[model samples]
Target: MPTITEAYVDSLAPNAGAIKNGRDLIKKNSFPVLNESPDATLLFGECNGSGKEPYRCSVDFVNEASPVFRCSCPSRQFPCKHALGLLYARAMGSPFTPAEVPQDIADKRDKAEKREEKKKDAAESEGNAPAAKRKVNKSALVKKFASQLEGLRLLEKLVLQLVQSGLGSVDKKTVQMIEEQAKQLGNHFIPGVQAKLRAFVHTMQTEGDREAIYSQAMEQLLLMHSLVKKGVSYLEKRMENPELPMETGTSLEEQLGHAWQLAELREYGRAQSGAELLQLSFLSYADAARGEYVDAGWWVDLSDGTVRSTRHLRPFRAARALKEEDTVRAVVRTEELFVYPGEVNARVRWETATQREAGEADYSKVKAAAAASYADVVKQVKNIIKNPLADKTPVMLVAFRSIDKTADGLCLRDAQGKLLPVTDLKTNGSATSALIALLDEKDLRDQAALVMFSHRLDDNRLSVQLMSIVTDSRFIRLLY
Candidate 1:
């Protein structure tokens, strides 16, 4: 049986409130374990709730990285308090005699095992199938690649037109043109790029500072054009030689908007041999123009000094409300993150994660491992400018001596007294202003701090977008 730890149980709780309530119940010794048992892969328990019957809670730990929680409680939160309490008790090493597994839990486990067996059998059978089927599949894939190439061509043409016409003169017709091409790209399995196009169009329609907006729009057009060009070239090469190993880390396909199924990614993470497990800290930003929320955060392999970024998106209503008070950071123990295809600080994705309280981040270690100086950041931005598809590169800057509001914009001064201009200060309403107000109240303008932000290279200039600020006492999230 796998040993359960209190930290692991805390990680399973949905929020701080749940963790507190569960711990309170455990402290009070109110949840008497009515039944308890552990198999090779699961833990089952019945805990007395505030009702006649106890709440039956079962934890499926067959896949240690992605545990499934089932509870009889009516709470909507995943792993409600009852489940947490049960786990907390087990983690505390409460003495309980083993009991026979309940029929319902046994049946569920059996069904899941059978499904796994069937999947294995099917995979083995397919692997042994005739060569004719494999040839047909390869032919189909080639045709699909051809269609994607065509879509890329269409997108490239649209981007060229946008550039020639000028963003300042963009109107409904120009928006329609981009939208049509975006639809085509979507159909070609490039929803990532399609989403970018739609976001560009949305920005064009929305009222904003016309000059700044136009410049940003032009920057986006150039980036999309580069992405399409590279995508087409990649497809052409794949078409020419099918056996060539495709780049795996955040791939061009993902940057072009390919959606990764969480389930599939999780399974891949589990099956990956000799992959390291690392804990990550998560922060989210709302993209109002795209009607989506982007989770932007980092993970560190404490053993190897390997730092990588993890990002995910969710539509407006579908996004979860991140509680400011609760420790919303995810603790990823079982899942291994795979970085996007190309190098230069690629984005990462994982199968799944469990929320946990994040302790104070080790600013010194993270800075030594991942933080870049202002000069290095600018150099990196220049490199990305050479390849426009590498937009919004994640950057961490440490020991920023001061942040001051200038007539032009916000400027962050590094320890060496170099300044970087900050833009896109606000994403969610008034967050930037709120942060400024907090800084004023706390008198932190001259204090040293760590800034977690992204840099966008556009129109031969680098613009820093503020995402979060970490002070000694707290983490201030500027984008939510």
Candidate 2:
């Protein structure tokens, strides 16, 4: 399923919740206005902004009949606030409308209707509509793969050029050049490679050690080279045996074939610690929903078990009301001491008795305190990166472009200023391909400088400003 982007939410917000109360309810859920339906769907209702202050429970009409509505209020589940809220929100709409309720909800509604119909058609009882199967075209896929290969080649050549020129020190222009290329490549859906490149470019901006940064770029180049080779090999094999059955004969189910294969690849990649990336779902919950997490605490995991970690309290932003469907619930079980990805280092410490007391006693004061803590963390992270790693590991630097109309594996740059050829590889196999497609279609000349932020698990403190490239100086000028 296509994840909802911020733009999608904003577009729906204007219509789905066009009415005041409806809008309020919609905003409280903080979920996106989904066009696709899940099995059970919740409908909108009136925004009853009553009760204990900011926490307003919207009414909702459930799938059940007798009462028709079920709520989250203390009284009864029959006509809950959640159901009412959903119905109210749906009642008043402008350009927006519920594209489709979830299949589950439809099933319930259908069941309700069946109670009135006595005659059941034999054909309807005997037949079933199968789930739709996703299809892929082999030739078209190969062509797309080939295009991405070209993009990879372009990135490699760019990086080599920098390496050859002996301009080890990266300036703003260099950063922009690399970042823009990477961004373009990101269009290909190769988040793994894009992140590698992004990491290098970001490090370069604040790096005190240019040599390490250069080495990092080189390492990434090598990684791309390896990935492309593997991809090409697989593509060739598939072409050779287009109709070959798997040795394991796991193709009993056609619709799930691709998913199973992808899963296999994911497991193998993880085991190898190869170019890997994680899909991050970012969400913010309203303060009113904090009750769910009042007792939760974090369990920090280190990439390498050797790194020491600690958690300290910091203020967090609380929504005035439960955020609308725009908000997402935290998947992690624990509540963050401050923010999910708290700053590694903080400048304005919040350890003071006054700050702690304010945070515990007043919501507004606590938020301010968290912001201050965030500022400190940003400074600390910068400082940490400035000092070369104690082990003096070589850093990887990368740059690349993308393929057109795709967001899967990236077309990686190779040694010959050509993209690593993936003519034989699957084009829409993974997120990497998607990223590659996206990057290939992007324009980097009008590049946007990377923005750095202090990210907690679920929160990002955006402290830096967005910068753009300037040609004459050939250096990235810090934006205010």
Candidate 3:
């Protein structure tokens, strides 16, 4: 059995809010009773919640791979804060008094085992029945493609008009017209493009430095143009085939506003087996135009050097039902990890995951995976973002001999003394780089850092954002 780690407990949380609430309990010392079974497979705690009576929470890990979370709380959230707090406390090396397994939990486990046995027998009785195949709606795809093409033409025309007329000529009426055209994209089932258009409109709407706004507007137009050009060809080809295989290298469907299913990804040979992932950083933001709150976490594949992301989209309309994602500090081991189509840091999802503590070997692997040279990684990143449709911001781990603040910016020196400038607050619209100043001298030397390559169109410079700094002794994350 593996030891529970901080990352594993974070993974069990429904959302960031739950993790915060759970952490608050530990900080306040609200749990008076923290006990574990003799073998430590079962953990029980009493956490004070809103109600006067404390909530009794039990996490039964009789099955190490898939533990059962049971809590006496009114929250619709599974494995509510109380249960998560208990797991967090355990991971933090909290001392739990040895105790016998509760008889009720033991009985429940017995019933569960019997149910599982029945399920296994029933499944075996089926005797190699083939799985059902889902039908494809070709007509729907065709109509969508046609409508999207029309929408693209309209979008291009709008941009051309705006550009030709110049920003100075744009008035309220013009903005209204642009808004109407952008809204039509929703009808074409390309809400992703629609969101980009809305962002462009927002840039125009905001009262800011005129020159800056113009530059931003141009950048938005360029980004959208990239999508439209490639998207046109992609949709046309898909329309002709109606069953074209999904692209694994680029996010064509995302731009076309298609939500991919796990089955589709697996069928397209995009699923990786026996994957081990560890989170490097987490991010959360509100998508105003889409009325959705998006939370994304970046995780490095311990098996390989590739970094993947897990995104949770909670729409305002479904906020109550959907949970917002948070940080996971544990190593995620899964049988099948579905990879979504995109550029660097492709979105990933898994139906089930088992997490355990990362050992020294694991940490060493991460350090070993870091690119020893800065120039090589930057060259690769530049090549990827050359295309307008390419994902500009991609996380890369780079080994640094030392970090020094120079006249330019926070620069990381390689063995060759080749410096890569980073730690720009405006690089990725984040102030996380400021955290580096708080670090002592020892932590800044002979380590590697995870950086996101961000292209600042305003400066016409490709900036690097330091997401976290990892050393043999510590992994300090600067991003949330």
Candidate 4:
């Protein structure tokens, strides 16, 4: 028998708003628990909802770390507010007298256990299968390497052209050329690279200011240069030693935008520990011509402090339908995460989750994990100057004292009077306005505010893209 903690339960919430709503239910005593029991590996409770009868809610903690939640509430949110309140009560350490397990709950738990056992049996059988079926096809492998080599050549050529012509010459025609090259790379089975190129083109097309766009373009170009160089070297090594043992997917493929299968990644993640859901965000990229919308989710490993991300893309019109719950932060179990293949900080997907007790949001802890000084961040960025992918490097500035409005744009200053210029303010006008309003309302010139941002190096100057602003009483996410 294992106990559920507040933090583990909170990890099940879809977003901060859900947790708040669930808390309201508890505070209002809206769903009074009628019958409560904690058995060997299960917790059951019946709570009065809006309906005539109480809503039956139960959490199966047989898995201990990753519990299963079920509730009769009609709410569309998984686990529903009723379920959250029920678990919240238990997480608060409310005493539950020992009682006989209800027949219904017993049956459900038995069925779940049987299903898990069957899954284990199937996995064991698969593992015991003949090794001949797992043999690699040398010819296919060679063909893939050759295709990647060709892609590397195309990428190298593209990089050279971008550098020679300069970011100022990047126009619709230039974008078209890059798009065509990206399509060719996709044909070569290197979709990771294709995606990176498409993202770069999208940024260049959407950004309005000529100088700012150039800076971003140069950053993208540098990333492409590094990726191509690394990819070529990796492929050459594989060609030389075809029998080399690679545990995970190659870093070159990931840098080139190769995505791992969700099922496989999930299986791999479940075998390890320390996975926790961290944040969720609704991302949008659009111009007059086209639009893209994505739901991005982040997970962090509590043990090793590794970060992974998952993304769900929707149609352009779907952007308007997104709600705050779609982008909330929570902690989840590692088994619920499916990690993408990468050297470090790989992307991940949410496989399975259940509602349980939740804990308070700790912004300080998150900031600490990602915090770095302006100089340190700049030095790190310089170290990876050859592979300057914007998303890969995130910096969190803790307790900056003031926001200085520069002639060009805004800048943030620390208590020690160090300054960091803010760049990539594109597509975050609302957040920017909100921060400015907070600063004005609070007279925060000398007050502390936390800033989460990323760096962009261009023309020997380091600039930051403000991602989020966190104060003592407020948290505003600026990045989409």
Those runs of model 2 whose alpha carbons end farther than 4 Å from true positions after fitting are: 1-136, 159-169, 183-195, 207-222, 236-480
lDDT of each: 0.62, 0.33, 0.82, 0.60
Alpha carbon deviation, residue 149, candidate 2 (Å): 2.0
Backbone clash count for every predicted candidate, in the order shown: 10, 105, 3, 9
Off by over 4 Å in 1: 1-52, 58-68, 73-81, 84-136, 173-178, 259-281, 285-292, 304-306, 315-332, 351-364, 370-373, 397-424, 427-480
Worst 10 residues of 4 by lDDT: 280-289
lDDT of 2 by residue, 1-480 (tens): 112223322322322233343346556753233221332334422234455433223211242212234333454322334443444334434222344554444575687668645344544554465533345576765564565555556656765676677555567887788878877875653444455466566556654566655555655455445444543454355555544332222111111112224333332331122111110111122122112212111111112111112222212343222223221111111111121111232101111110011112222221122212223434554554433221111111112232222253223332233332222211111122222223322432322222222222123221222121112112122221
Candidates 2 and 4 compared by TM-score, better number: 4
> Tens-digit lDDT track for model 1 on 227-294?
88788888899887765544455357677655555543543341332333333344556776567766
As for TM-score, the candidate ahead, 1 or 3, is 3
Ranking by TM-score: 3, 1, 4, 2
Candidate number with greatest lDDT: 3
Model 3's lDDT to the true fold?
Answer: 0.82
Collision count of model 2: 105
User: TM-score for every candidate vs. truth?
Assistant: 0.67, 0.31, 0.87, 0.63
